[model samples]
Target chain A: MQESATTIAIAPDQPAPRLLEKAVVGAGARVGELAEADALIWTGKPRDFPSTLPASVRWAQLPAAGIEDFFDAGVFTAHPAVQFTSAAGAFSHSVAEHALMLLLAGVRYLPEQLRATSWQQREFFPHVGSLRGKTVTIVGAGGIGRALIPMLTPLGAHVIAVNRSGRPVSGDNIPAGVETVPTDQLARVWSHTDHVVVAAPATAQTRHLIGADELSRLKPSSWVINVARGSLIDTDALVDALTGNSIGGAGLDVTDPEPLPDGHPLWTLPNAIITPHDSNPPQLRLAAFADHVGANVARFVAGEPLEAIIDTARGY
Target chain B: MQESATTIAIAPDQPAPRLLEKAVVGAGARVGELAEADALIWTGKPRDFPSTLPASVRWAQLPAAGIEDFFDAGVFTAHPAVQFTSAAGAFSHSVAEHALMLLLAGVRYLPEQLRATSWQQREFFPHVGSLRGKTVTIVGAGGIGRALIPMLTPLGAHVIAVNRSGRPVSGDNIPAGVETVPTDQLARVWSHTDHVVVAAPATAQTRHLIGADELSRLKPSSWVINVARGSLIDTDALVDALTGNSIGGAGLDVTDPEPLPDGHPLWTLPNAIITPHDSNPPQLRLAAFADHVGANVARFVAGEPLEAIIDTARGY
Candidate 1:
């Protein structure tokens, strides 16, 4: 690969130090020196567009997993000619592991056991259900789902995948015995599924996909795990499902109205495990952004097709 | 496969009315009518030995997992000529799954998270360690360990096995990656292990095997899980280890003094998850004993070796 002159721009935050150290392999400059560089790397919150831009900036690499933030800022529409890419596969392992941790915690009744310790009722321990020989359904068959399939399949679970498009593709590492179903048939399969994982991207058509209607179709012993965007599930419907015992429990990494207000019902629910949207592993964002910037820089000089190029109409 | 006259014997409490109503193609007589039969099959726990046992009693099947009680009652040793077997493999899946459930529960801080919810500190979520890349040492390379290895390997964990004699043998379904170590090396390997699972049988040499010395060798972040007999771990040492934070936590299905007293200190420890001696799945013992009886019947007719034949000297 040729050593090219590229300016990798990042947000002015704590992660900026690591990003500059990793992405800038040679004598590369920052965003202020944009006029003299061939490409610009973006890693920050969305902001107003720059009026004076150089025509030489042909590609832009995003540090975030989802590019919706940039699309909302209209960065893509203004720079129609510039190719954009994102770091989607970077956080799959961390997120998938987090989801498994939550499922195991819920099913084994860990919360109740902990409380029993304080009351001197340790001898009344109950036998909790195991995840072995259970069915798990993944709603979105993307980077995260693909990574999770391999981990779940080996635990003797029957795995099924649902995708947006009608066509089905076999997961590379997923065992042959696992089944793959279409998104339209999720209602038919929901009753038999013991665990449901939602990893779909947040979009206009995907918002509130698992509302009251879908929740009603779930079995009382089933558990819902959401590692995706909070908008994918209706918070009110989920709370009702949990309270009515329509589903066994829920492990939520994201909640609607992010940074849930004090006295939220979800905080006190016995069947819920909530984290402050920090499920993503520490330093993952910086690592992902560095990879994205390196890939785009390679593509810029090699004249090859860029990875994870965003489509304006899809708004991804 | 020969159509022989068989005398089927059963304990007085045997509930076989449903089985009697099903199809019976073979010519067989009950134990009460043993005078007219050529061979004999037995079920359930027998109360006493007959003074002049019929020569037709070619086999004896007891409905139990551990035959130690029967052996202590002078049933197997006295009638050495009679082929003997007990249920073993039936409960392997349930027990192994229970061990994994406890390990996951402890590592994820499920107990602490639940307590924090009731205190109105939802924003103070803490990050616990993940089991994705941890090393788990399973003591006892018998049926339970064999069954558990396959389930845990796929969850991205490194599994190590320790057996009595340290002999290495490969089975059909055991994944190739598992490592088998001798029991003598447990102390040497304790510091590096993240999780320790005790699945060994109760024997003379195994009693108090995990006492104060062994407990002290464990790393501060390590957790102990005992699904084996109560005598395998020293209760006092375990409490001391947890109180000092010498080890991270413990998930004990069986304690030295089974059915711990009302005000035991171990019961009040925040880091310990104590389940009653009932981690075995519902109806697991019955299913296992039934399978054991069937195998013994087949072996008696074929002149083959019986399964799970306890070694009196070893006391397993």
Candidate 2:
């Protein structure tokens, strides 16, 4: 509306999503045409990205966290002058929420209670556990893990955020009491923490991080929740521990042989809660991306550093 | 031990429970016999309470939150000089945690997911909801409601705490953003909030607070969680809402005609989650009570006003 107002264009939708339009405008930026806009908020696939962009467009916001396809599509090379930001951390809140739900469900013994047809008060009493005063070792201090720490701490669960460097995960939202542990020192964590939540990226180094030996060291009441990639945990070992009731339970959104096959033991295991990797479903992504756009747009309008900026050289 | 150190006595158990003794000692008090004690920590029934207390005894801590049985036993009348404290807020954490578990479970569509034997990611995607940017109206900002507010806020929920007076609910643990509404104003909340947690006490005026009318106002995605006494909701209306898919679901730790009759339709409802009021089970009580004892002991030793002190005249 003003000469100095920053203009952001929304692509792929003839009329962009109302939420995204509101976010852009709410953050003190105006939605406008791509040719005249200062930045573009993209929701379409990398393949469909514009072959040419006007020089006025200085920034582009991608809809997905991982922009590997964008890298392969050479979207970065053609627009060398433009700054690009991915929706990396925007989607983590929902996944972090899912992790908390799984941990709470497993720790409090919800799967068993869900199956009960009658009131089993006396019988179920001993099994219902609380996280208060218990240590929850989250393997990986990434977006999801960081988001989860605050959620768990309020429920009285002590958080041990496992990162590669063991650097303390300090943030405005994260309480000061969280412990930081290095991935190399994970073996020491098993004997200490009451539960484990695997949220690490799956790499050759991270694969099978929680095997039988690690599982054996954990207490019988300990629960293991995996919201990251499935390969981070040894699924066979997990099934064995679950079958023997050696560990309390496993709440997994991701699985090793994903889709998990129809007759997998994890399906029937009383303690295992499988949610089919629907933690950050399609419907929720637009809102999260809109939030990312709003914050970045606010930054862009103010001529400040933007979030989740892509490293063109490194191909992230 | 210092000569001026506080002396608290644990009755009934020969060695007095180790945890309670540890709590007393941890809180800078020395656990001693009733004859030499300045305060008595009673874990026994109202009938088993010592008929008489030493003149040195100036305070008494009852194990349960509700001290009505102790009142019925005429314990307060006999020990007119002793200050009394009930284990009220201490045990609310577990129940609050349980309420959260139920809410998160219901909101995220866990009941249906737990029943799935195969991968149904596409089918489950739309049902998976997040608390982010959602309104959660907690009825009755008591200990449990207050405890829950802090937990929900970290997950990006805007909390509206409903109390009888609508006095703003602020505590060390509770963040500053919570909106408080009085009981009479609760009718206006159902239409706006995405979820409702019924934590209000069951009083003559509060009974059936959430009937068919209230349920009808909530959206199809709204979940109703009741951790308080079941009478606060009309079970038939709740059934209709849950059965007709008029509401998202009901996650109830307490049900009317509780111990919720074995063959009740609630037990079999796909959308209904029943935990048989076992949120605060017997097994978890000792630890919670010990925590209460520790806090009270610390307060008593510091010459500070003790928590949850019951007035003999009012009989809480």
Q: Provide the lowest-lDDT 10-residue window in model 2 chain A.
A: A1-10
Query: What digit string (tens of lDDT, one per residue) describes model 2 on residues A27-104?
Result: 999999998999999989999999899999999999988999999999999889989989988988999999999999
Q: Best candidate per TM-score, number?
A: 2
Model 2 CAPRI quality = high
> What residue pairs clash in candidate 2, if any at all?
none
Residue-wise lDDT of candidate 1 within B159-184, one digit each (tens)?
A: 88888677773576678877778887
| TM-scores for the candidates | 0.71, 0.97
* Residue pairs in candidate 1 whose N, alpha carbon or C atoms collide under 3 angstroms: none
Q: Fnat per model, in the order given?
A: 0.25, 0.96
Candidate closest to the true structure, highest lDDT: 2
Give the runs in model 2 whose Cα sits over 4 Å from its true position: A1-4, B1-5
Model 1 stretches with alpha carbons more than 4 Å out: A1-87, A118-127, A166-169, A283-316, B1-43, B46-63, B69-85, B118-126, B284-316
Worst lDDT 10-window in candidate 1 chain A: A118-127
